[model samples]
Target: MSESSDGAKDPSAGTLYPGESPRVYRALFNIFPPYLFGGVRVRHIADDWTSVRVTYTVRPWNRNNPNRAAFGGTLYSMTDPFFGIMAYGQLGRDYRVWNTVGNIEFIAPGRGTVTAIMELSREQVDAIRDATRDGGKSITDHAAEIRDMQGNLVARASQKLYARRLRR
Candidate 1:
């Protein structure tokens, strides 16, 4: 892993900082105002950037008036960012990646803590690399589900991402 001038591992260096990267990112996300106030917490990020787990707690500040359930926006926000980050990290500095669009469908009211697990397979990474190898662009869709502590599905989300090789 590469270190910055200040001695902290440089996350943009396309290498894992062992146990540090995930913890650093998790801390950053947890303290981010939007996520902090919304009761969204990032629980884990795989060292290889293959998966992420996030939790959304239903709090008075983030509950819907109708039933004191988790707000739809908070649920959706919990599903955002992971896929793009995974793809970007897995694809490395040679490629450009972005989350072009996102959508969420509520299946049930989330009254307590809900979790979303996002995953990207090696096959998916290979496919994206193949599609963008010749300086071509590829648009792919990724999905995740938010489930309550009881393992009941509370929401489903999809993100459309765009990737292209950066000309060297």
Candidate 2:
């Protein structure tokens, strides 16, 4: 993403670090602008994946059950975008990737910074091709977890990504 502040110099030169996905996630984040339940930032993206960290703040409107904790939906939303982004990064510049299905389980109340880590293995990418070998769309399962600042599991989500080779 363009971290360029007002009238400031552009650092990082728009180059994706080696071993990192070459897409600008923060720009993509602004495009689909989530309510940003908290001060979330894309800390690092590499190996065809990205990790975002959420900062906690007390906001009255976020309380869904009068427990005044971070809502479950907020945690789920943090994980939703990773599947698509990670898949695309692996598919490189040759395929189209979309989320076909997803399910999330809330394990605990999130009251502090949470980090969502996502990645797709080499095996998963090979499986995608094997499943779509007949030229039909293929579904590959992927999973992500949200961990609290103390490295405690807060939520887990699994999704099926639909992938297809782009027609040249």
TM-score top scorer = 1
lDDT of 1 by residue, 1-168 (tens): 334346786444444335446668788899999999888999998887789999988988789977989988889898788887888777766678889999999999998899999999767977887797677998999999999999999999999989897896
- In Å, residue 140's CA in model 2 sits off its true spot by 1.4
Clash list (residue pairs), candidate 2:
none
Which candidate wins on lDDT? 1
**Weakest 10 consecutive residues of candidate 1 by summed lDDT:** 10-19
lDDT of 1 at 148: 97
Residue 162 in candidate 1 has what lDDT? Answer: 94
Q: C-alpha displacement of 25 in model 1, angstroms?
A: 1.8
Clashes of each: 0, 0
Q: Across residues 1-168, which tens digit of lDDT does each residue of candidate 2 receive? A: 222225454333223345443346654563454545344555555634433433333356565557766677776777676666766665554567788898889898776567787766655765665565456788877888888778898788888888886565
